[model samples]
Target: MKEKHTWLDAVWRILLYFWALTIVFPLCWVLYESLKTNPEFYQDIWALPKQLNWQNYADAWTDYGFGKSLLNTLYYVGGTLIVSLFFTTINAYALTRMEFKGRNLIWGLIMLSLFLPGVNALVPQYVVMRELGLTNSIPGLILLSGLGESVFYLMLLGGFMRSLPKELEESAIMDGASLFQKFWRVIVPLSTPGIVTVAVFKFLGYYNNFMGPFIYLSDPEKYPIAVQMYSANKQMEYTADWVTLFAGVAISMVPSIIIYMLFQRLLMEGATMGAVKG
Candidate 1:
């Protein structure tokens, strides 16, 4: 039987629609603005463009140095994802699945750290990076991000790992599989959904990270898209090329949009599974 819609349900639906419009309207506005000329944009910020100026995209790509920044972002995001995911998976597996001394103590420490403010570590992190001579380089940024494991991801994956059937590892052990073999062959494949969820969240965080790059890097050429876009904003004060800047902003949004579109289903599935398991 179809459930009857109540007044509360109608109110929730209206609020959800309003929230969706709040997000979608700005994106649609920015996209069209990127395709307009400066005169058209200046004449009416809210009006639709009469003609799409494709040249704005070209100008943003070439003149504004977004092309190089795009490549740098890809490299940084990819490397950090690979390194961080590897460590996070291993750490989660060991903490959740394996029997080891001091494991509970270590986990408790990690959980406790979650309550601590991350900003407290910034000065010490910078000093360590400076001492290692790793500041202002792409590898330095990658190392910093990769080594600093996210407590949330660790817990998320750990919870998922705990939900896995113990029999799988038991069978592997009976078959004379080593500890590494059990983890690799039995656990890793089953935990893929959880891993992908963590990856998506991490990708967004690392891709859009501005503070690390801005504080650690001084060279313009080494800047990622976030910093490069920020620099572009500063330059916009003099150039006054608002449309090209809008184009650049649109370009920066593309990768994140694509990632979400492609993996939206898996993300939902993963989150649902994690919630159920927790």
Candidate 2:
């Protein structure tokens, strides 16, 4: 059934649209500001630029080392996503479907850890990284992110996995499929929506991560786009070349925006189904 229309509903819609504009207008302003010169920006912040200058993006790319930072960010994000998602997928399946001793207890323990503040673990993480000789390196950062795993992803996927029918696993079992084979062939494929949801989130977290790179990485060149953008903004303050700084901010925003746009449907589905089923 369609949702009933009412004056309150109409008013709510209008309020939501107004709220949306509040967020979008700033992004629009920043995008246009990135095309203006320093003088033009100061003269009239809201006015359109007389000319489109692609040079801000170029300067942001080269002068700010965004190119290198982008590669490093991708490396960290991709590597962490691959490793974390792999374990999250299998673990979610096991906890949700496969009967095992202490399964619920393990899930409870994992969820319980989420209540503990992440900040408290920083010193121990650093010490462990130092002992393992993984500090100040991209791979080290990747490992750090992938380590401990994410209780959120596990929970989200476990919820989604519960919604899947047991018949698929039973059919695979009748075919003499082993545990790994059943999971690889049957479970993983059906779980794509939930997996995509997890991937999209992990991408955003890794892309915009500042604390991890800032703490673990001493090398400026190894900094991810988030940290690099911060450094670029700080340097640009002296020059007052606000356009390029805005360009860097715009660049950093692009991936998360793009990923969310592409996977929005799956994200909603994963959220809804996970919540309902789990």
Candidate 3:
């Protein structure tokens, strides 16, 4: 039995290593390509750069307007997180904890919306933004992006909330705590894992969003990192600076990486907790 178990463990370890490599290899290749000259990149696609090209990052930062674009991305991401998290949390709390009429129907509708392709609404969304004179504005983009609570987040947090002891809220209510107080002091604090998970998702989504800004933002100065990267790639014909373009891509990815690394534990806990409970 011990011999059989040892063989199984060895096979599992090899499979796990292969799985990790499948995901990690592409990222490593990108990093390697970012350091190579265009000719070298084409010549040896899988090999490491002969020497690290640190100037690529600096060139990308300055010439590609990534510095300004980074700032704009930070604003959009921060605003989206603030607005989306606020609404999602409140909506989740109400749907899960409070009694209401037609709750199931409302939830069903939200689930249906999740199935609708986002592109289908683009024309209408653009018209509304134009009418509101929100085109090319960061706040407008943030508000439009944060229009509704995602069913996924609502359902995830609802599961976590369900797993909590009802007696906690009941005792607070018996102690003369208002509904707002209970939410603010008791539930919100306990729901940290769910909140962190939701925030991480929103942050990543907002940071990487390109289409909305591309269609609405006419001014180059107002463009975010993703748009700026697009612009950089396009201008490479006149500029002929592949290094800067790669650098811009690398820079654009950093914030999302940092955020995921920081909140990875919370994200995993929230996702697994919701999945198991639900």
TM-scores across all candidates?
0.97, 0.95, 0.91
User: Hey, what RMSD does candidate 2 come out at?
Assistant: 1.5
In model 3, the Cα lDDT at residue 116 comes to 92
In candidate 1, clashing pairs total: 0
TM-score leader:
1
Name the candidate, 2 or 3, with the larger lDDT value.
Answer: 2
lDDT of 2 by residue, 198-275 (tens): 888888888888998999999988999989988887886588888888888788788788888889999998778778
CA lDDT, candidate 3, residue 232: 88
Q: What is the Cα-based lDDT of residue 69 in candidate 2?
A: 90
lDDT of 1 by residue, 187-258 (tens): 999998898899999999999999998999999888899999999999988999999999999999999999
Give Cα distance to truth, residue 89, candidate 2, Å: 0.6
Put the candidates in TM-score order, highest first: 1, 2, 3
Candidate 2 lowest-lDDT run of ten: 143-152
